[model samples]
Target: MTRQRYRQLRYPLIALALILGLLAIHQYRLYASPVTAQRVQTVTISNAGFLPNKLSVNKGETVSLMIVNTDIRPHNLVIRELNVQSSDLKPNQSATLQFLAEQEGQFPFISNTPGYPEIGYQGTLIVN
Candidate 1:
């Protein structure tokens, strides 16, 4: 090729090579990143207390707990160990608590709503 023609193509060739390099790096990152397991569990709150009062998950997994209030009062869920809490949910209302189960142990969750008995409005989260 003539010198003039080579000069005209040089910039575009470099740009194409840079773009391909960037794309290759992006694909490598997507492949090298770890994939975490996601879990969604639904818990219903009623006069009888938390339905399925026990939850279990594996370590390093993401958990999404959907809490639905089906009783005649408002309530909230708290897991101090995991630093997870949900907004007060009125009767027929619902809330979702999301967190990573990084620790492997049994954690207790409870509703701190006034006038509610802690004994009945509590549950255990078992992380393995």
Candidate 2:
């Protein structure tokens, strides 16, 4: 190859190598960084029922579930695994509950409001 053509090719190859090396270093840094799994999720309650009866989150993450009672009657949200329980959510009222998803499994929730068995309140939280 001509001297000028070889020089031009060599410069481009060197630039490509540098770019690839930088990308690899960046990726390594990202992987080596501390990974703390934390997340927040919102849930709404309406006249019909819970907007999302089932929620999915990553293990070791904390979730903040916002419950907005849009119904006339009171309702409650209970998660046994997280030991979280709330009651007396009157109509147009809102409440917030926090819990950490340390277990990797499915947990159930219920309203626990009396005379609401027929209406039935049930949900699940899945962690993985």
Candidate 3:
């Protein structure tokens, strides 16, 4: 091809190459990265304890445990086996615990602070 003709085509080719390169990278990331389905569950804490005493989820899912503290005292929720816990939540406050449910079993969560779990600040997590 003539020099002028080649010059006219060079930038377009470079641009096309760049676009293809970006698309390839995007495709690689889309498939290579692990896919996680985000799950959000809400449990309320009152004088009685966790609103829903029973919680269930499937394996390989990331769970967002949204805790709404609606009691007169502070409470902390924890699932020791799952390595998930929450900070002390004052009355009417809320906290979120995000964790990956990697194992399949029944995990029990209780209040980390004393006198709470025994008083009913507890629940069960069934992972299937």
Candidate 4:
């Protein structure tokens, strides 16, 4: 190729090579990282409180808790031990709380919404 033609193609060739190198690095990282299977648990919220209030899981497992609100007012769920909290969900709305169950013990979760009795809206997560 002529010198002028080479100059015109140089920048674009460098950019293409950089883009390909980044993509190859990303693919390598995706494959080299460890993969953990997630465990899903559904908790329904109502005036009566959380259904199936007790949840059990193994230590080091990831948990995806789907909280569905079927009540007339908004509410949120909180797990103090795991530092997990859900957004205020309106009627017929839902939110998900995900975290790694790293500790082996019983963690309590509850709805802190006003006017709801703490005793009535409480549950436990048992990790073994």
Candidate 5:
């Protein structure tokens, strides 16, 4: 509560935020290529394609999809039927989508980006 103490605390908080931002940027650059780094215990979308087209997960398992737009053009990883999708992804950008596979059976996914014909940009989630 003194003015000087408050100022000192603010400086440390700002410094911590800056350091975290820098670390995140560095990590984004490192894993932006392959999309999934060694530390990512989940799936990755590499080269405009889902690394594992068919994912077999158990029901109620927590699944994380680390999707990166490695393609030059913008794209999206969408599972419309499942009502799960990510915002548009620009090249060299990455986003993590975490969901619980609570149901069993096949779930299809595709690139919901417009103007691009649907190619191999599709995948399935096979929950057991």
Candidate 6:
């Protein structure tokens, strides 16, 4: 096409491209899996061990746990089944763990911080 025709068609072409891009995004969102809510559950770690240690959530949902280590020594939160482990948080330190609950089952978590587990630093995460 001539330069004049090309220039005249440019705006329409750009508009078409924009519309196509938006349609692609909309289609993707329609076919995509629904996003789970960002819910947070806090657990306090101290001499008393995990407060409300029996955590529960729905399957296919996301799990976000705020682990507050209120003890003088560092502690770790580990879920062997999910291979999820939190850092050895120092005294009064806090950490957050986020993961998808892909499976439905009862998973046990432990603290691998030197006798912490034996001291009652154990809990269960139930995904239904």
Give the TM-scores of the predictions, in the order they appear: 0.70, 0.63, 0.70, 0.88, 0.61, 0.71
Q: Judged by TM-score, which candidate is best?
A: 4
Task: Assess candidate 2 and give its TM-score to the true structure.
Answer: 0.63
* Tens-digit lDDT string for candidate 3 (1-128): 89999999999999999999999999999999866547679999999889898998988887878999998988889898878889988999998887778999999999866644556778999999
Global CA lDDT computed for model 5: 0.75
- Using lDDT, give the best candidate's number: 6
Which stretches of candidate 5 lie above 4 Å from their native place? 1-48, 115-117
Model 2 per-residue lDDT tens digits across residues 1-128: 89999988998999999999999999999999755435456667777677798999888776778888887888878886679887668888888787677789998877877734426577888889
lDDT score of model 1?
0.88
Regions more than 4 Å wrong, model 1: 1-37, 115-117
Whole-model lDDT per candidate: 0.88, 0.78, 0.87, 0.87, 0.75, 0.89
Higher-scoring candidate on TM-score, 5 or 6: 6
- Sorting all predicted structures by TM-score, with the top scorer first, yields 4, 6, 3, 1, 2, 5
For model 1, what is the error of residue 108's alpha carbon versus the real structure, in angstroms, after optimal superposition?
Answer: 0.4
Off by over 4 Å in 2: 1-39, 115-118
1-128, model 4: which lDDT tens digit per residue?
Answer: 89999999999999999999999999999999755547579999988989879999999887889999998988888987789999888999998777888889999989987745465788999999
Worst 10 residues of 6 by lDDT: 113-122
Name the weakest run of 10 consecutive residues (lDDT summed) in model 3: 112-121
Better of 1 and 2 by lDDT: 1
Q: Rank the candidates by lDDT, best first.
A: 6, 1, 4, 3, 2, 5
